[model samples]
Target: MRIMAFDYGTKRIGVAVTDPLQIIATGLDTVHPLQIIDFLKRYMQTEQVERFVVGEPKQMDNTPSQSAMHVKGFVNLLKKTFPAIPVEMMDERFTSKMASATIAQSGMGKKARQNKELVDNISAVILLQSWMDRKIY
Candidate 1:
């Protein structure tokens, strides 16, 4: 089954999706918090997403940060928007750092690292891939 993943930020949300077999995850796009609900409403209608895996932000000490509250709110929005799909949260402590390292290793220009949306999108892909790797047998 296909799964949708989200990296929720204060201003923008990164999105990713797994294939129907849940083997590979791909970065989709980053949307403004204000537009996320509408965007997902349309996306879910077209894409065959069976579930949602939202990244749960926590500090290096494993303490929940204030950002987690915003993520919870977004999770509520996802539940209201796609009531049929089950939503789960996976710890996203180091996704941003991992994404940055991945991008730098790819030899992307510094300008790309400055792009919050791009970074967040790749972070979402990492988050989804981690979730799939951990949860899939």
Candidate 2:
């Protein structure tokens, strides 16, 4: 079964998917918040997703961040829409920063590094990879 990951945001949601063997996580795309469910519906037609890993925003003090409320609402909707697929929340602290650093290290040009979509996509990859690593070892 394939596992999917989402980095949810008010403006954009980052998407990632694992291979059939569930070994590697790869960034899929960045979609608008309003279109996320529809996007998933279309994607699910072709891919068999067993579970969803959603990034949960948390403050350094272990409290939910302001953005966490939005993520929670989204998660609720996801559960309502896709009851069969389990949804798991993973801490997303520092993922954006890590994505920025990764982009900087990549060979992409300055303009590409500044793209919010790229950051979101990379952040989704980081979120999924973190979950996979935890699950594996």
Highest-TM-score candidate = 2
- Give per-residue CA lDDT, model 1, range 1-137, as digits (tens): 68989999989999999988889999999999999888888886777889899999898899998898999888998888778999999999889988988888899988887888989999999999999899866
Error of 1 at 68 (Å): 1.0
* Whole-model lDDT, model 1: 0.91
lDDT agreement of model 2 with the native? 0.95
Q: Write the per-residue lDDT of candidate 2 for residues 19-127, one digit (tens) a residue.
A: 9899999999999999999999999999999999999999999999999999999999999999999999999999999998898888787887889999999999999
Please, what is the TM-score per model?
0.95, 0.97
**Relative to the true structure, how large is the alpha-carbon lDDT of every model?**
0.91, 0.95
| Candidate 1 worst ten-residue window by lDDT | 40-49
Error of 1 at 84 (Å): 1.2
118: Cα error in model 2, Å: 0.4
The superposed Cα distance between candidate 1 and the true structure at residue 63, in angstroms, equals: 1.4
Winning candidate number (lDDT): 2
